[model samples]
Structure formats: C-alpha cells, structure tokens
Target: MPINKQQVRTALTHVMHPEMEKDLVTLDMIEDLIVQDSFITFTIDLPEKNSQLESHLKEKCEEAIRTYVDEGAVLDVTTAVNISKFRDREDGRGEEQAFPGQGHRKKKKRQKDEGEEELLSGVKNVIAVASGKGGVGKSTVAVNLACGLARTGAKVGLLDTDIYGPSIPTMMDTHERPNITTQKKLIPLKKYGIRFLSMGLLVDPDQAMIWRGPMVTSAVKQFMEEVEWGELDYLVLDLPPGTGDIQLTLVQTVPLTGAVIVSTPQTVALDDARKGVAMFKKVNVPVLGLVENMAYFIPEDRPGKKYHIFGKHGARDLAERIGANFLGEIPLEQAVRESGDAGKPIVLEEGLESRSAQAFVELSNNVIQQLAIRNQSKDPTEKIDIKIRP
Candidate 1:
C-alpha cells in the first residue's frame, strides 16, 4: 500500500508542540504535507526562533513517518520560524494563525456580518459551561452534563475550550488521538458515548500552556472551524475560568444558544458568578441558569441533615435576582470528585441512586427543557442591544 496523507496527519497528532501543549497538526503548524512516490515532506510553523525546539519537532515528525509509513519512505521535515506578526492565509478569510504563548500580536477582529456557515453549520445548539472563578467544579459539571445528555440518546460533542487548563482528557478517561477526515477536517475522539476534543489529549501530559489572548482565540476558532463535528444536537464548550478572550471570542464566532454558569454557594463565588452572567448578557448570549455546585454536604451517619458548607442557595438566589433560570444544586460529595478523577463521571455510574449523579441528570434535563423554550420563542430581535460607537 502507498503512503497516505491521512496516515501521516494521524501520526503527527501525537507529535505535540512542547510549549503550546497541543499537537502540531491541530495547531495548523504542519503545512504543505506532500507525499510523492515514496517521499514525504512537510513544513512546521514554529512560534519563535528556537533551534532546540525546531530540532526536537523535526525528529518527532521523522519518527512519526518512520513508525506509520512503510520501510524506505524518505521524510523531509522543514521548520519555518515565525516570532513576530501573525500570518494571514492566502485563502482570504482574514484569519491569522497565532502561535501558542507567542508574545502578544494584534489581529483584526472578525467582521460582524460574517456568517457561521463554514463553522458550526450543522450544530443545532452550542451551550457553554462557564465560571467566574476556578476550583468550583465547572469542568466536572460540564463533563457530567455532556454524559448525561448522551445517556438520553442525544448526539453530543464536548469541546474543552480551556486552553490554559484543559481537564477533559483526565475527566473523560480516554487517551485516543483525533483522526483527520478526507476533507482535511479533524474528527473528535469518542468514548463513553460522547465525542470530545481537548488540548490535554494533544500535548504531553505534564506540559503547561502559556498562551496569549490572540493565541487562545485562534485555537478556539480552529476547534470550531477545523473539527468536523457533524450534526450534533448539543456542543458543550467547557470554558476557562473568568470573562476573557475565550468567552468573548466564542460568542462572537458562533451563535450560542446560552450559557450555564457554575459556582459554589458562597458570597465570593456568587459575586464572580454575577459577573459571569453580566458578561454573557453583554455579548447577547442568554444566561441559561446558574448551577450551585457543592451546595451542601451530608454526613453518612446523619443522612437526613443538610450542611451548607459554602452557604445555602447562593447561586439559586443569584439566578432569581438576575432573572436567569435556576438550573439546580449539586451537593459536595467525595464520590463526585473520585469519579471525575477515575474518568467515569458520576452520572454514568450504573445505579441511579447517587445524589451527585442525580443532580447532574436533573441539570441536564433542565438545560434541555430551557433550550426548547428558547427555541420556541427564538427571536433575533431579542438579542442584547449594544451599538459599537465610532
């Protein structure tokens, strides 16, 4: 059998860019991959002029070809160092590719009228799970919500947009690499009845991402446009903590259905969650509701008792005050944490008696119900009014 581009790209997904904490192919760093006869040659666009990294990437690419291609296949890997400005593609899309952690470079914002026909064209609804702060179990909630929806027989896609801190790989418990489609689109990895993509699966396990605003935005754009997420009922984006580039960029790039803000029941967390809701509202993305994770703790001996560890119903109250729907509360449980670490979300547990699992299942149901309501009353004129001033 002759060597093929798909095989080469699949192998390169394992060859991660050390600093970016992502695979070369997904980063669009691997360009002009041409296979003629028994020889393969490709160009890698490096972020900076680092000879050490350049040499390392070249060796890895060569190794990938050697491992995947038949014997006697010659590989010519070349490096193109780009340390300054973002490069525009010849395709005239006005999109610039930014290298992860590259010093900040300015790129023109996408035109408002540019439709999403090329990206997210087949997705029915895109929901984002966000938080104002970290360690509030946002990613956990996202994973379970996705699994819960999938359990209901819906075709789902989970996208980890947390470039700075990706957790889907560990939470989903799958190490599968993505495959490239014949049309040059990346196919998401599937496991436990859910399709998912995460930077965690693309990079070395211990590597950290030190990306700038543009770099993060670029990556999220690629995840939306390059990945072939065909006909999904729901595409749950697990966003990073805070209201920054990733959040704003996503809302502007895709027509989001709504957002689910997660927070512990506490004054500090609620304050941040309020900001999160405001941010989404400012961007015209409806605030679906707030999920009060770690709402309380119940002792094994005193099964009937509810302890308000963080404070009772803080998120629920916040939701009511802001006029956003209140999704539900998730109690603090060891099983929730353990299951997440085990790569098996509590909602996917065999039995239906687990409290955490039940809470997530209920949350998913509420989200679906709310989405249905929004779709019924869906009106473009209802979008948040904000005029850009000259």
Candidate 2:
C-alpha cells in the first residue's frame, strides 16, 4: 500500500515539540511530508538552527514513524534553521540614533505593579503539583513526572517552590545554585535533561526559610519572574504542603495552566486533598487531575501482595466524586525513596520489570494524554467538571 499523508500527520501529532510543549504539527515544525511507497521524507523547521536538539529530534521522528509505518521504510529527515524567528528586533535605520547628548533618551517605562505581576519567562505551561497536607509524596510525584516528561523529549522545568522544605534539589540529586546571566536573569540548574530551580539551592541546606507570608510570596514571585527558563514546554511547580499564602499568591500572580493534586489513600490526606481542590476552585484555578501517590505498598518479594497501608482508593474515589480526572496511582516503594535520596528519580532508573517504575511511566503517559486533550480547548474542566461544595 502507498504511504498516507493523513496517517503521517496523525502520528506526528502525538510527537511533542520539546521546547514548545506543543505537537510538532501544531507548532508548524513538521513540513514537506513526502511519502513514496516505503520511503518517507520530511522537513522540520526549527525556530533556530542549532545542533542542540538535532540528533534527539531525528531519533524521535524515526521512532514515531516506524511504529506506524513499515520498519524497513526509508526515513529521510532534514532540518532547517529559521534564524529570522530568533532575531532581535532591528531599530529602524535612517532615524536619529538615541545619543548620550543634551537630552538623554527617555527610559522605557517599566510596567506599574510589575512586582505584583508574576510571569514565567519562557514556559509554555505552568503546572502546580500540589497536595493538601504533607507526607503525601507530592514532591516525589512532581520530580518523576517532570523526569517522565523530559524522557519523552519535552523540555521540562521543575521548580521546587516548597519554601519550608524544598526537597527537589536533594530528590533530583541537583545541588548547583542557579547562575545569574548578564541580563540579570537567574539560570536554572539542569539535571537529567530537566531544568530546575529550588529554594534549597538559594539558601543554606541546613537553614530553614523562617520567613513570614509576605516574604515567602516575594521569594516565589522572584523565582517565577527572574528565572531564565528558556523555552520550556512545561514548568512543574512543587508547591508547599497545604493551601496557604504561597499557594494563594501563586494562583493570584501566575496564569497557571492548571494544577494536579497529589494525595494518598488515607482519610486524613484525602481530607486535605479535597481542601486543595476546593481552594483551586475558589481561586478559579483549574484542577487538571488527581494523582494517588502511595496508593498501596507492594512487597518487592511478593509482587502479588498489595497492602493498602494507607487505605484504598481514597484519591480515586475523591476524584470520581468531584468529577476530576483520576490521572493514575503510584505504589509506595522503597526504591522511590532511595532514588530520591540518591539524587536520581526512579523514572530514570532501570525498573528491571519493577511495578513502581511502570506505574510512574503509566502516570506520565496519562498526564500527557490529558494535557494534550486540555490544550485543545480553554476550559480545563471541559471533559470532567464535578461541582463540589466546600
């Protein structure tokens, strides 16, 4: 059979643009799709021409096409750098250049209330991974999910915004403090191909952030505005436990794409998780879905045994009751904690057919699939919006 253009486009739609966080087809990166019999050729127009992501893109395209087409098909990939898209705006020539003469050129007036306005410089989507209370493994889910997205060729950024206890630096095994650029922007630390910034890096590890609400809010605002996160597809914010000042400030200041509530299968945690969901609803921030972390503990030796140490299906039940998408459940495992301590995410480690890692991978896939569906419209609750009164 002859190669089909629609099939090729459909396959490409599932391939996300690493930097833009959008699909290759949606970003107009995939072009000139020519398929003659078993041979396939296509051009990918990058925003800027560089070797930064050439090999990775080629490999991903080949993998995606092969899944749909014949494995023996000829794949020809070409990339063109469109520098015009990345060029700085040129000053109109023939006009008098602003000189350091008699009257100094008027300074560009900065926006009033710039301090109040929080913006993520180059992130396409800001996802707050939050929990109602602590000990729900919110940070673990955030880190692994960020890694999962990165593994799938998305340029992901993880922000450890838990001021009181910023565990991301330790969890992700990243220790370097962000460097300031000439533009006065803070450059985030990179680890496992994901960019990250954390309060742990900014302050002494032993010292606690003993600041009031206002100070914490200011620090978060600075983190959001001053960080030079260049062209990220998703910026996952690990919010501190509970619905407090920092959470409120983030919702008020940043145009968050949505939130994912992490909770355990315990009544206490579920109670708090519900509050987190209600808080987002009150603030009009969309709750993307619910993640049940530590849903059950499965013994490594006896894979058949699933001990519901916390409780069973608390988060999943809550999600269903509230009409929110139940993203997925992550089993409680020692490897997850060990990985966090070792500064490596379990998602990056070889699972050796381990169920915990498989759970994470499945969770990541579900989140991505939901995100793609959500991106198709503005309403976050378009598919599943359950009205729950606090």
Candidate 3:
C-alpha cells in the first residue's frame, strides 16, 4: 500500500529527538511532508543547526518510516534551520532589554495586590534553581535536587519554567502528555518519584519559543496555578537563565521560599551568578545558597589528583561575598552527564557510593537545613525519613 502523510506523521511522533527526548512531530519539526506510493519525504525544521542532533534525528525518522510503512519503501528526509519566525518582535521602541553585563538594570516593581496571585495549594515550600547565564548546569542541578529531595521521602514537584529552553523532559526522560483532572487541573508527569512539568511536554520541541514578555509571564503563571501539584513538600522550579521576563514573572507571581543559584567556577559564570542572587533579592526572595557545578575535574585514573578547570572555589567565594550560604560543589564527571542524557538523574542512578551522587544528597540536606533556619518551620527531616527509591 502507498504511504500517506497522516501515516508519516504518526510514525514520526515515535521518533524521539536524541537531545530533546521528544518526537519530531510534537516538536513541529516535520514540515512540507509529501508521500507517494511507497515513497515519503519531509523537512525537519530546527531553530539552530546541530549537526549531531540533525543526523541522529534523521536516522530515527527513517527507521520509524520503515517500521510503519510497507517494506522496500523509499524515504527522503531534509533538514533546515529557520529562526526568522522565532525572532523577537520589536515595537517602536528599540531592544526590549539590555544585553548581559551591559548595565541591565530593571526598575523593581512592587508586589501585586492581595488576591491577584494564586498559590499552588498544599505546596509547603517553593525553591527555584536558577543561573545568571546558560551552560552552567542549572537544569541538571534542579533535576537532581528534586530527585534527591524525593529520595528523602519528601513529596517533590519539579516545574521546568525555562520556556525558551525547556530541558527537564529530556533530562528526566519523560515524554508523556499530561491528562486533565476532573476538576480541570493538569496532571503532572511522574519520574524518579518526582512529579514534573515542562513546556517541552506541552508544545512542539522543534519550534523556537519566541514569546514576548506578557505571553511568557502568562504561561508561567498558568503552570504555577493550573497544574495539580498535590501536597508537595518541596516544589523546585528550574528557571531559565538570566533575569528576563520569565524570572520576573515567576517571582512576582508566586511567593518563593528561596532560590538556589548554580554557577561554574569561572569568572564569567560567577559574575552572572551574583546577578541571579541580586535579582531574587530585588523580588524579596531569599537567596538560600549557591552551588558550584563542574567545580573541579578528578582524573578517573588518578582519583587523588584534582584539577581546577574553571577555577577553584569561585562560587564559594561568590556565595560569601553575596551573603548567601555555600551549599556545595559538584565536580565534573562523565557519569553525571551520561545519567542525565539517559533520562535518569545521577542522584537516583548512582546512589551514595559515587562522589557526584553524594554531593547531590549533601546539597539536598543543606537546602532543607537552610529552609528550616530561614522559616523556623517544623523540621522536614522529622516528617520524612531518607529513603532513596529507584
């Protein structure tokens, strides 16, 4: 039988992107699809050209087509990177916000009137994992933190509010669509004992999210209020890097208990990490601490030797300078990276045996301790025992 466009699309949905962990069809990557008798062709659109991702996805798409279509079918897949549609729309005014380190100062706005904001009911504390810039392993820290907290038997919810670069779905290895409850709340996806949600799950992965300030804020507000995050002891929000619209909207919308800043042991990253702490303070959110990721590299062959790749204790000094707690430092490790890419966090995959996994556990314990000191609330440790379930 001849191949059809609908059949091709259905097949494509099973072809998960290696990095995105979402199907091409869901990412809106499949474009200009044409099918003839036992022959099919489609264009895979990308926001940027990733030769590795493109090649991997192309192979997956071809494999999927063959499985769904008749034997001896011919498939032609093309790749295109078009970001024009995703460009920021400018009004009569010039650029909306200043670039990083270029005197980006936003006037602090007062909190909204009472009753204007809705809280996620039953969530005891909300913690945000944020960085001043990207490539500092903020998402990785957020994911592992959530898993670590869950390992402590706390009911945890991971909310990926990095709308522009949502990576939680891929890191957590979940691609299931959420179902709406009878009360009209969206059910959160579960993995590694943590309930989570991300824009990657709700929208096409391949499409660039070029939403304006208002739109970005609205989506985050909805995610915070509309999702049925039931009785969470700790709700960790993986915020997008920088103090942009999403960051402002989140702090303004919800009463954040605290924020954990992630940064590398590099001057540039430390500079941005300071800005992250400042932003939270501007919004009256407590800066719980700073976590230094990729702090050092320990050679696998020589475990005793430590090399300061980015710089030694850069984040620790920054934390002290900013008057925030120095949570802990996570070393550079291949296991951590491989675990995240495989859709399972290292904290859950490695347990307490490995050094990287132990760091995450220590980080989680410190977070709980800091919150106790900050809020003087009941001891979280007393409420739940430490139980790391696979």
- What are the per-model C-alpha RMSD values against the true structure? 14.9, 16.1, 18.0
Taking the tens digit of each residue's C-alpha lDDT, what string does model 3 give over 1-390? 546678889988898877767777886778656555665666676766689988888998888877876557787677765342223222323333211111111111113355543366456678889999898999999999999887755567899888778889889888888766545667677666677999778866455366666666666777777887765668899988998755766676765778899999999999999888888878777788999999999999999999999999999998888678999999999988998889989998644777899999999999988876665532211111112222
Clashing pairs in 1: none
What lDDT does each candidate get? 0.76, 0.74, 0.76
**What tens digits encode model 1's per-residue C-alpha lDDT throughout 1-390?**
767888889989989888779898887888556665576767676655678998999998888778877557787677755332224344443433221211111111132345524356556667899999999999999999999887665657899877678889889888788766556777677677567999666654344366556666666676678887765667899988987765666566665778899999999988999989998888777778899999999987899998998998899999899899999999999999999899989999888688898999999999988876765554321222222222
Off by over 4 Å in 2: 1-118, 205-208, 379-390
Name the lDDT of candidate 2: 0.74
User: Mind sharing the TM-score for model 3?
Assistant: 0.66
Q: How far is candidate 1 from the true structure (C-alpha RMSD, Å)?
A: 14.9
Clashes of each: 0, 1, 2
lDDT of 1: 0.76
Residue lDDT tens for model 2, 266-367:
999999999999988887777889999888987878878889999999999999999999999988888888988998898987653556678888887877
